[model samples]
Target: MDKDARDFINEYIASLPWLTIIESVNDTLVEDNYVGKIVIQSFKGDVEIMITIPQDFPLKGIQFMCIGITGYPHLMPNGLLCLNVAPAGNLAGELQEHFSKLRTWMMDYYESGKQDAHFEYYIFDADPKITFVFEEDGQKTRPAHCCGRFSYTSLRQQEISDERVWLVTGIGDTPSRFSATFMSFHQPTYEGLYFLLSRPPMINVNQGLTEYEDLLLLLTEEQKGYFFSTAASISIRSGYQTGCIVIVGYEIPSLQSGLQELRWEPFFISLQEYPLKRDPITDEIIVRPSSVSRIHWCKGINASYERMFGRGRLCSELTSSKILVMGVGAVGSQLAHSLVRGGCRYIDISDSDKIEPGNICRSAYTFVKTDIPKVQELFNQLVGISPHLEMQFNIAIEPILDSNKGYEKLKMYFSKYDFIFDCTTNKHLSIMLDGMQLPGRIINLSISNMARHMVVITGVSQIHVLKNRIYNKISPDKREPFYPETGCWSPTFEASNSDIAAPLHYVINELNYRLEKQLIIASFMIVREEMNHSLAYELTYDL
Candidate 1:
């Protein structure tokens, strides 16, 4: 470091009471040597402390570890301070700034008599939709483990400190994949998405017990050590009344490596004042003394789409296929849900209309929005099911269908998807798209009166040819399939979701194979099903 910088640090040290400079190599920050060390006698004793110049001083921040006390109240096992919660940040401040924190921490630690500090317990993750049933007389059980690392306990009080710990149950350590902060829950009966998860009470969070008597057992000594540690938080629904114990507590840090060279391990603790509190001054946390709290900990199952269906080959492949869906009414919206369930992650939905009172029974959105665009509504609905799903949608199907409204350039944009589904049943728009040299495979899907029969036409410019083949006419009535529902121009197809969905699903299964390797194959799918059901009659033609 610069000589002036070192000189400033030394001058500051001389002013500190009970703190004396033992030695300073001026050249090495010591005279004679280009590299040297600085030793200081502190409150601990003559051998009180030493700040390691890990690299050139001022050029690199100083690192310090007492040659004495190790772990809690004193220092970590490696003798270093635990300020680096995740990892020690590069210390760049002047000597006074860094050393002052060390001094205050050491003095407080000494005054407190090295009492044990508490941390929060981090459960790997849990499910949202399913309710874990807890028996009045606990019996069934499983095995799990509490992972590594330590935490700082100096600042918070004995009873109300906001520390964190963790437990991973089920098969093992959650396969070590990158996990998100939280998991959302969904259920068929529930009409909306939610984030609340409830599970059974722990059978045993008792000390010296290797496993949690609840659903799973903790495997390691680190976990066992943590089992003995107490955890405290404001009780929401504990005791025999709620049956479900909500181990609510303060905020926990992201799980990562412990401070520098020491591992803190997990533990159980008791609670006094509420663990979570917002401070007004330094906004720092203040906790009252509370004993260690203990109860059995359990890991909930993760039921995400990727976790549930990623093992299948078709599901794996389809997730990577980019599907562009135009007109998300009854058919398109249902198709989007099916695709997401089949692990189709990349998708785009576009619709020119909004949901209306009459469209509720057939559309995908379970709830009603006053005048929200159809695409945005479907986009948010799909994301609620699978957080990993990547999709985008728009409300410009009308503009793209009109030549004067920039329809000619729209084909270039639509051509990027691997498969394009036109559920709009718009004959003019389908015919216009047929004339373009699209990069993606275009499949024009339409269901006739009451959904008694349906047709899916694939390949560029084949919409007319397939219709001719299916209807047996060179030019059939352009509006032969639709009839007025409410007004002259507004025609509605009476097919129910199952009536249209069954045939569309079968065709999609075939297209999954046909769309591979840039194949230019043209085909037609014709199907007629029962009024009460589907899959009655189906045929495919390759032309």
Candidate 2:
């Protein structure tokens, strides 16, 4: 402890007449790097207790541990009390709050237990090597079936946190090549076994499982026979490239979800080669396996659709729809980012320019300079956002618009998508798109000078109506002047990324709402930021 902390502790202890310090001793027994202990008299009676302070005292806070107490649900093996106290604030106030809570806990402990309604026992302990990712578990009647044998794929691998992370492609016989269409499905070479138990595999409810034999107690006689035979068969056939994985699942009820979900704990075990003997009476082959090698546990991560995207936040239409975004400039790049984060996976981006240093200040372009085209760089960025994202990029939109047979080629290309977002502020392009008989819907998105107004025009081609709406709604007096990219004069609008992103958030949410409700109509809308620091929305037309 520092001088300030020591002085504060001394002054605080002097003020409490009922509290008396017995001794000060150095100790480091707990997991939180405890530095020292202060044995003090109990606030109520003659009993004594120790208050252990971690190395980073005020930062990590302090924990109270009884000297020789037992049978307390909140106490750990080192006698440390598991007090769910908030982070430490002002030193004087935090010390006062902690002692006050400790006294209350002591008072309630003697009267009755203080266990919460949603407490559960730990089944098995493990030192995780890799994070196992799995699909989302939707609303089901029971947890995933814990059959004896299972299969997993190691094709998709990533290095995360200094370890190799593998995804759990499937749990049972049928495996899905989720989003990765290029991968072909075949019989997985790696396999493992699992066991399901109604009760925890423990010698006692409170004690931890230490040995391999204790696990067999939780299994039935029939399960034991199947487990031994499977282990023997796998040990004989399996090579030593990778050890086997055994999963133990327990049906634990949680009050938050009000469902009995399966709590899974996985471990890496070795079933290399076991000895076989013949039974005397039945003349049957019996396989006896060796003891469990390592009891370390591996981490399991749920990357299911429900958990990745907030539950029900991603709509079916948005997820399944193929979107084409044109002109990856300031507004268009931000819109592409918003679409991907909102769960639009399949997107095609088109841009004809290169990313310059100036674009980084007001656009999604990174600081790293590259000789590649903007669409290629943007495609690389979007693919890194999520493993499920599928995208392609091209520099053909501008060329197609300028050609003599532009409408024919553009219509043929645009028909492949469900929605085409036009963020290019080119009037000629919008006019041309509006006149063409296109198959997909055209939605024009743009921001005015100083990001004072944002316009969104949706449904069957309404470029003329959008222009009329903008002309009638925005006043000439409220217009702002244009600014140059550098000292040289190249006319461009003046607005930082934040200036545009603030209103674009509302636009994306509104678009999601429209898609969810299937309200794809010819509509013109404008978002205006008032001088009074308030926002207003104008719905000019909806047909």
Candidate 3:
């Protein structure tokens, strides 16, 4: 016999409470040929296991039977244990290594007397989500060793008649393969409860498995009221060659009515092919990926989206409003793209600036003619993807004060719009629109720091209205004279002098830089505003 088989047998024998060695098999006497029956009569108050092993076992593996009702792998008909590790078909080959590990596990169970006992649990009532972080210290600092997020549901029973079930539909960054167990119970008697643990079949991708694949367990009303305490263990092995392991635990529902609680604790084991390192210049931590890293990262985007949002509610509130993008420049272009991908349908865009060679890096409409205005070019691009999209082009026109006839044009253009976006940094233009007191909300976006910085500010008339009411102060006049020194677009120009050029270099770069910064700020403001809207709706429901 191989050393591994001998070690397995020894470990299995050590775990049993009693072992009876049968002297002979089939009434034939063979040297060193004996059968052993090991029995675990009692474990942790209510579980038992029985095993029969033929000495010089024919298959070099032990055959075990579970007689009790509480432990895992509840025996089915035909004397086959429904163990997760013993699935049928090709997938069964994947468990060979785990089988070897289980042999050693029996020894560990004997030495330790029980499985790892540490657990951490979290219950998020507002979000109706439960999270478990299983670790030695309950900290989630290291991703390599940490179990990723696992979403769970909560069920409550009121006197076994009234029941409430809440499902956890969305989760972030969960593992590809997982399992679950459900324990349900009612009030008063906590000891007698029905429980069900299930390990579903593995869901595989084209060649690999999905990262968000998980098991769902269902329980009946009888199970909920009778089963008092439940425990679940989840193991996740990363598909990458690094082979990180994340183990988690969760306490099943308790019978007591007032406030049932569930929690999670996680454990992490690292399997790195190479050592991690820190960059000398950037001081950023980096881990070298094994050869299989690329394969794991090459999953389909559709699959990923399905895994994350398939069970969650669609964001209907986000779809109700239209997003108007005024400029298709660097910042406005990116914002429009992001908004479209985020599920906004109705978009209106405008930009007077023409497409130049330098605009390619910043603008989404890269296949435009050199002389086409950015707005017209971007409109064509957007319409190509969505033929019925609403769009307008007020290209090559500079915004001027109402006293100069430009205000009438601006008013006509903005009359039907829900929101006005200012992607241009021209102070004169901003001042003119601010003065007109446009009927709709105005969102101003700018960029700075080489396109990295952005600021977004929504100019709502409510603030002006509130200021007027509270302080009895008239809001400052919207129209202000452009200052020559501080203004981004200079007034000095000589149309007749063909040889003389305007201060183009300084103005263009500065305008782009400041707009980037303003756009960043605007992005934050928009997100906060949306979140506030969501909260307000939630509060209204509570009321």
TM-score for each of the candidates: 0.47, 0.70, 0.31
TM-score of 1: 0.47
Q: Any residue pairs clashing in model 2, and if so which?
A: 126-297, 127-296, 127-297, 136-304
lDDT by residue (tens digit), candidate 2, 1-543 = 565666667667657665566654334336554333344445444445677666566677777877766545665555677777776677777777777767666667623556656555553344555555554343423325445665555534434465644555544553533455212322355566667787765544344455555565676665666666676555433322446666666665533376555555666655444333345787544433453433546666555444556643457677778899998889889988888777777899988888877678778888775556888878766766655667888885653353576567676777888878888867776777776757777788887777777777765666757665674766363455565455766667778988888777777777777777988555555556565687665544542
What's model 1's lDDT at 101?
A: 69
Candidates in order have lDDT scores of 0.49, 0.63, 0.37
Residues 334-397 of candidate 3 have per-residue lDDT tens digits of: 6555444443446777667777665564456565478777776666555443322344566644
Give the winner by TM-score: 1 or 2: 2
C-alpha RMSD of each candidate structure in angstroms: 23.4, 6.4, 24.9
lDDT leader: 2
Model 3 residue runs over 4 Å out of place are 1-318, 367-371, 384-388, 404-406, 460-543
Ranking by TM-score: 2, 1, 3
- Give the top-scoring candidate (TM-score): 2
In angstroms, the error of model 2 at 272 is 6.9
Candidate 3's displacement at residue 287, Å, is: 64
Stronger candidate by lDDT (2 vs 3): 2
Question: Which wins on TM-score, candidate 1 or candidate 3?
Answer: 1
